[model samples]
Target: MTKTARQLQEEGLLYDVFEQELTDIKDRTYGLVSELSRASYFDTEYVMSLVRKIVAKIGQDSYIVPPFRCDYGDHVFIGNNTYINYNCCFLDSAKVTIGDYVYMGPNCNIFTPCHPIHHELRKEKVTEYALPVTVGSHSWIGGDVVITPGVTIGENCVIGAGSVVTKDIPDNSIAVGNPCKVIRQVNDKDREYINSLILDDETKNSKYKQEHGYVYSAKDEAIFNIVKDTVHYVEILNKLSNSEIQRRRDFLRTFVAKLDEGAMINSPFYMEFANHLEMGVNSFINYDCIMLNNAMVKLGDNVLVGPKVSFYTAMHPIDAKQREQWLVYAKPITVEDNVWIGGSATILGGVTIGKNAIVGAGAVVTKDVEPNTIVVGNPARVLRKITAEDSKKYQEELAKQKDINKSEFDKMMAGQWYNAMDYSMLKLRQENNKKTEAYSRITINTLSYKDRMAKAIVKEFGENANIIPPFTCDYGCNVKVGNNTVINHSGVFLDTNEINIGKHALIGPKSGLYGAIHPFDVEARNEGIEKAKTINIGDGAWLGGKVTVVPGVSIGKHSVIGAGSVVTKDIPDDVVAVGNPCRVIRKITEDDKINPIRKK
Candidate 1:
């Protein structure tokens, strides 16, 4: 009979089963470790000779660790000074690399091979290869860690308990838990002291300790303590030697050379950039892989780009209309260094991606990306903070793969195959080709504010750029606008400068504008306030149908006025301005929208 949950819990059956199995595995793992440790130098040499032979067959740094086994070894590389503790397994049909001085705790598994998830194909064993997994040098992976395929863990990092490493981990960090996040940074203090001992030729650690005072602050002290405790706790691991330069050369020659050049491309690789192009680097007209210029991008490298994954400097726009603009403007975006583009991202034109910022993918960047931030989603929203440590880690991890032996690995990877012929060619040969077409309209419009203004009934409004109709403001270089605005009927707005509009504005249609407002003090205005106060628009403003707004007024973020109301005042947000002076009536509120009569 199937066991009931209650019965199983009361009898401790589940725990017993797990414990027994776990104990068995532990015992086996412990035995292996003891055997390796107790062996004499000659015996160790013999075991390694056998190990080398097996590794040659299964690939370098390959060992079975007793309880853990796999189907293939062609795609695995383990580095030196590493250990894989009890209950560790690897499904490495895909390439997997573990670097030097690394440790893996109990029950850790690295899965790199992939298969179709569809149930219909479950009976058929169909599979696809993915990118390799790389664990960089001097890393400590805690118990129950699951390293997925295509992940690269940077050097000198500490992964916390029960963590599932999904994305890439940068170097010199203390990261923890599922979807692992970097919580702290590694400093050079420890390394400096360690190196000093060698320089001083001190045999005893006590002498070295005596000479160095505790200069670290409280926070650093805490971090030091944690790292100290974790040092010996590391046990499980897999290892390999550094890849020779020839190998790296071979891989680059084969892989990078095959990449298509020019304005169109379709590859999936990441490119590291030189120091100079950080502020911005123009695209080579293709979107195959990422061009990483972390150092310069951090400082503000200007990168010019073309379409399709073309622009990625900042987060998506917040304004509804502006957000929609991304479909068209999400091209040729620019950014300064220290900027991060999240996965599957998009950015729009004529916008600057601020320094030290992150833009999450699938986001539609419409506005400027702020510096030193973390933004996410469709219209990217800022969620938290960022620091230089993130940048440091990125640099370290990127450098780890620098020494991979590409040539030898590649010779084994090559194969001959041909893809299916183009459908168009096939159809033509079969005399089966057919074509269909469709049509659509493209609309455009322009309006002049001043021309419309002469015909309006009411007058005596500020002659500022903000007076232009809402839609008409699109083309005006100098047109100033107000905050919380509702505009109607297209109008042309001419903007020079010093055009200021108030908040909570409402404007009307077909208004013609000549907003070259001069300073009230004639002589001073003649020189043209070279750096005049930009047109200011206050908040919570409303404009009447067919009304116009003049620039050079401060507008608040929230406020409302009447429709068809010609505004001249520097109206503030949340006030009810109307008529010529746009006299304040009553304050607007959510309750007013719900119950107008009651508010009145």
Candidate 2:
């Protein structure tokens, strides 16, 4: 008999299934990569082994392979022979699963999990959450792509590179752009033609059939069954009764405990902290990198992060209208595999950069970026298409530079380097000092009432979590949040009645989440006689900096709210919403296509 939830909880065995799968994937990927590099050409067994590892990593099998770069020995899973080409990333925070025969090009990333949005809490040392990523079978991920947390990529699709996938991708057809979209269908002829290229010979055809468990000529249910039984990780819940604050604290502590082991960073520059780095095989993080990485950050294989790159998955809010409010928010940033991020770039809050996409220099990306395209400028726009020419030229340039600059680079890196664990120890000491300093209970008067409110606000946040001030609300009882969610210092969350927020939702600095509002009528507004309802912020929703979510609004599951926008209405599930009054600018694309719409 299957184990009960109670039994699983008692043993802490709920995540055990995922842990085993992850281990298997790590072993397989390590073995396969070692073998394939030695083969004269594409070794079918080696490739199959790699594919099996990805499948096992994700808890599912039967994935298709795109013509792509396959590397690493970590938690990675791909469905049966999914077509993946040069430059793809599966930076498995927890685990990454891809469905059958998915197609992809250069510079693609699947980034899962991020950090909190408050520097104070980060500096104090706290644990954050990680969300899983899934790509369905037969999906085509284009070049220059990025896939963010808890995102689902659907089947039989085409995604242009240089597009950022921030939410779930649906099945079928073609999608492209900074935010990928389904533009057309992948008709029967297209499939046939593509298959013909692989199935030209009987020997190759037989191998494909045996490995995939079916002939290519017809779709088979047995193959589908094997594909369906993949593993997945679900967040387990403890039944103990406790205040919201205590629960948050416990969760953070537990999550941190799991991450304490395994120092995962390697760099060629001045390292502030090295112990917190989590990297995949064939992944290279360049010089002059600074990360508080206190809240979990991740990277995938073949990922090229440029010099002087600042990854701040932490922030704080401070303002009178919104101080120490609890509404379940945190901003985490993710960069997918095979992605090329330019020098001096800042990727902010719960942003997911798709695979094979190029982020231009000095760009301040305040929102999610798409795959397979070139993005430049402030707030980053899709500037041009990334073709084969671009890929070849860049590779040649990289190789030539590696040859010319290797010895000098090695000599430079030989001194004063740091690892990922140093950051963890530093954070631990800093937080300990803060606790020692707080023995006398320093109180801020003149804002005495606000202090009480701040206490109530703190009740909704996790320990070592920061709450920005300058906001007011009707009642505090109705607001609640999960662990490790941060509310910036100045942001306002007016919880007049009930407001429920899930774990690891990124809410930016200076943003406002007003849970109660009056009708436009003056008398009703003035009398405080307005009807009140609840606002629900789901798990993993990323609200950008300075964005405002109006009263009675329910931001749906895993949606991305762009920065500086006024959200005047309701937003549905799995989308990237931005602009004034917050229109549904685009449904989160699944195919990871970049530059879908030509700017011209």
Best by TM-score: 2
Q: Highest lDDT: which candidate?
A: 2
**Could you tell me every candidate's TM-score relative to the true structure?**
0.26, 0.31
lDDT of 2 by residue, 1-600 (tens): 976433332232222212354445534553454333222222445555555553344233333332222223244665554555432445454567776555554335565534332222222222233457787765656433567656787766566534556667677655654345566765666534333334345555432442332223222344223222210000121112111223433432342222222212212122112223455434444333444332335665445564435564432221101111210112445677666665445565457787667776435466777876667644567877667775465345334543343332121122111121234433432343232223112223222343334555433754323343323232344557655555543344544446777665657544556543332222222222223456777765777554556556788866777654456578887677775446786766543222211111
Which regions in candidate 1 have their CA more than 4 angstroms from the true location?
A: 1-47, 56-68, 126-128, 189-600
Alpha-carbon deviation at 123 in model 2, angstroms: 3.1
TM-score of 1: 0.26
lDDT of 1 by residue, 189-268 (tens): 54454333233334433212222321122123433343233221211100110112233223333323121111122221
Per-candidate local distance difference test: 0.38, 0.45
Give candidate 2's whole-model lDDT: 0.45
What clash count goes with each model? 103, 121
- lDDT at position 203, candidate 1: 49
